[model samples]
Target: MIQKRFGSADTTGRKLDVIGEYLSMYQKALGNTNFETLYIDGFAGSGEVPLAEHTDNLFDEDVRTVIAGSADRALNVDPPFARYIFIDKRRKCIDALKAKFKDSPNAERVNYSIGDANEHIQKICRAEQWRSQRGVILLDPFGSQVRWETIEAVAATKALDLWYLFPAGLGVFRQISNDGTVDQTHEASITRIYGTDAWKTAFFEPSKQTELFGEPVTKEKVVTPESAALFMIERLKRVFEGGVMDEMIPLGKHAYPSYYLLFAWGNASPKAKALANRLSKAAVKATDRKHGRIV
Candidate 1:
């Protein structure tokens, strides 16, 4: 694949590690069952991302420059998935990925398509074949571009586990923290992202009506990034039956709410919580190691 300008983040390794480990366990437990395991990555960038460029300030001392990303790392998981599907909207990214894996033996098992990731997610869920289509979906958008509706569709699938990379600080939270400078476009975006007009309540207190003109004045409060993240996590937990976002793997030590890893699953089976718990702990440990949380 011709190198693209995009590169992996400092936390990329831990995220992929968590996914690989969890999927390995998943495959082991379900391999003998009637279900087929799938590995899917939406926003699967070029197969290889050079970390050297993206994390100079945080991880410049790390030995590796490039790292194997989700699309490639998914293939590396043990007991290999029965199928792999990678989606990206960029034509160059798709073309680069296709050429990268064209000669691999597992090439035949892959399905690459060019389109919007969220639209394809809903399409996949709505057309799901029940037990025949079990999967692990990765939603690592470039930023907070993922629509709330897409998450709703994925939850409806009831057969897939989701590993979502949510942008908290520099993405969604920042976009709305314009110091009371939110315009109509920003309001619309917040509504779309939350899938409701209710997010205004998180930052702004209810409006007060004046007696003189009977005009309403809405006061926007100071919503910290941390609080914003909690709001989102709670919202997702309500949507996903077995969803968990209590503890997350932050991208950096204290980037004042940077990116985070959130996993969601609706499977009622006992293994669901167990897997979530294990991965969450692992993510915390990984984040600690990065942030000097280690003893």
Candidate 2:
């Protein structure tokens, strides 16, 4: 098999570690339940992500290790999920995953698909019998690939917990221009991501200074990159019935926040919500402590 190199940072390992931790806890909590638990990896990449370029900052003592992708971590969970679904847009990625897991003991229990992650996710949510199925989905897209409706679909299931790697610095923060001169394309993408145009008011404000012609310049941005993640959390709470985590585990090099790892539960039941919340919080905290962060 040809090894494909994937870009990663110190926070990449941290993000994967958090996913691994949550899956283990998720399995343990529901392992005895009558409900069939599932693990779904949206935007599932190759089985492993090689970290040759950014190994120095990785938390693990084995600096030369290849980081296990989310799908790999899910399969490693003890008394594994009853079913697994791995979806990726790239044919090569799905092929690689299929090849990597073909000989596994649980290969029969896993399903692989090559297509849009959002489409596959929505189909699953709409088709599933949520009452008898409990699941966790990892949405770690390359950029702003996840649409708002897709998120709504997940929440509608009322049985799946979501770990979303929102592109805070890399996608949302980049789309928003400081001078407020966002192009039509960016405006549309941002609106699609936030599910509303309210972000225009939340992240920007009217500038006191005006152009030479006395016409007001585009609204000046009122928020910084660090605060963007917080804004997203607020938007997520509106759609996720089980609510969202108050804070996100920022994924990037030290002090340079890129991706925001957000957790939201779909289950509306008090007991389910509390368990998911507790486990998710512990997972993030454990990952941070392991990385020597002062969380």
Candidate 3:
């Protein structure tokens, strides 16, 4: 059974719980030797969140429960050799993570980095210690914090399985369509993640119609969260080799916010495919639950 972390239930917490459970199960089914370089949480948050679902009251938060669960599973495996590398931009998040995992037996094996995840990737990848191991990177950026070049660089490593949290609905598409300023930095960020100029075409093309908030949309349409997500998933598929793409929806009645799109790649083995399928199904179930459907 999976251990529950967050006390008060909310959309984000439930979603994290589902992800953690599925990931742990996937690791177990794949067995101990399946991966060498273990987990990577790019947008590693505090192991909890402070805001309650309906209230504005502030409280302590720590969102690293998923990482904690993954670590526990890794340590229980036979070899006990897997390592976790967590990266976060905020020092507060780093401190919170440290406090949350203070008692973890695998804490010593964990590597925590404070700074831009992209800037540190080369250093982490080139380090002699991780050269021989296979990797699974969980990129859960808050918005569009991750760059496309970083994704490409990580892909170049040729031994990575990426589980990305794309900002399709929440960030890129919405901003580009709604905001007039069209900042170079934002454009560059989108290009980096998409790894191509195709997005420009999508934005400018007259015939392309995208759906936003369940409404039929055109090039001039405001970027809906769904379309942005779909756009990212499609582009990511083009760049990454031998990976399955799937979206994760939340479960239960509190599901109005957003969903996750998981990109699984590396080795292209049967195990990878199977894990992708499992995760996809799990995502749907979680989404259903989030919407208050009986699943």
Candidate 4:
């Protein structure tokens, strides 16, 4: 499939490894539940990457060459999923993905599309293939590309599970300032990502900042980067029927949490909670080993 230099942020590999691990675990844990499984990768990049060649290995297995994308990894797992849906915005990525699977015997089971992941995902929710299946959707966007409405749609399905690579530290901490005033566009992005403007309540105090002359000032803001991340997680936990698990923080080579990895599922789903807990535990340990020291 499409191959890129293994040179993105350092935590990129950690994120992929954790996602791959969860996919394998979920398949093994629920494969015999008599339900069809559908795997979705939002922002599925080119099918191949230089994880081994350019960065330290983070996967459970070691490889020195190019590595399989999440889409391919899921396909290789035991108790195969019933269907695979991969969506990427880049046409080249889609073309490469198709080329990678073109000769495969199970190619017919995989579907690739070039478009906004959120839009296509809503379509998946409406498609007959996803109607009765257990959906596992992974969203690994570059920045604030995933919106809360997307998560809402998946949760509305009442049958979908979600894994989000939320750029809490990168997106929220950067845009939400120490002062009450937020960056214009970032305010919208963060509000949409959190699915509510109420998050500002967590960051800013009710008391307003006043001008030197005693005029009405904007609200005062006070919160740490870590707290900002928690706010996002907590807000999302409320949206999913299956609560969002404690976050798995992946460290950037720069020695900080690059993003918060979280999973959420439908309401009143004990199975969803159990599976999410398992995945959360595994991701926590994996992130510790692979990227914790850098932090």
Over the stretch 1-295, how does candidate 1's per-residue lDDT look in tens digits?
A: 5454333454566666666666666676665677877777889888877654334567465534677777887776666778888999998888878888899777888989799998887887787675676778999876667889998888777777888877766565677633344667767776766677766766765435323246344454566666666667877887787766576656533354466777788665677666656665665565555544522
User: Relative to the true structure, how large is the alpha-carbon lDDT of every model?
Assistant: 0.70, 0.83, 0.59, 0.73
Worst 10 contiguous positions by lDDT, candidate 2: 1-10
Point out where model 3 deviates above 4 Å: 1-10, 34-37, 55-81, 126-132, 178-181, 205-219, 248-259, 279-295
lDDT of 3: 0.59
Give Cα distance to truth, residue 141, candidate 1, Å: 0.9
Q: Estimate each model's TM-score.
A: 0.82, 0.91, 0.72, 0.82
Model 2 regions more than 4 Å off:
1-9, 54-65, 212-218
What's the count of clashing pairs in each model shown? Answer: 0, 0, 25, 4
lDDT of 3 by residue, 1-295 (tens): 1323322355554555555655555566544653465677676666654433344445634333333333333334444446777787888777877777778777787788999988877566555344457656777666677777777766666566677766665556555754223578777877776777676766554425466568765555444556666777676666566565565442222443344555656545576556666664665476565535432
Q: What is the TM-score (0 to 1) of candidate 2?
A: 0.91
Instruction: State which candidate has the highest TM-score.
Output: 2
How large is the C-alpha RMSD of every model relative to the true structure? 4.6, 3.5, 6.9, 5.1
- Give the C-alpha miss distance for residue 68 in model 4, angstroms: 2.8
* TM-score of model 1 vs. true structure: 0.82
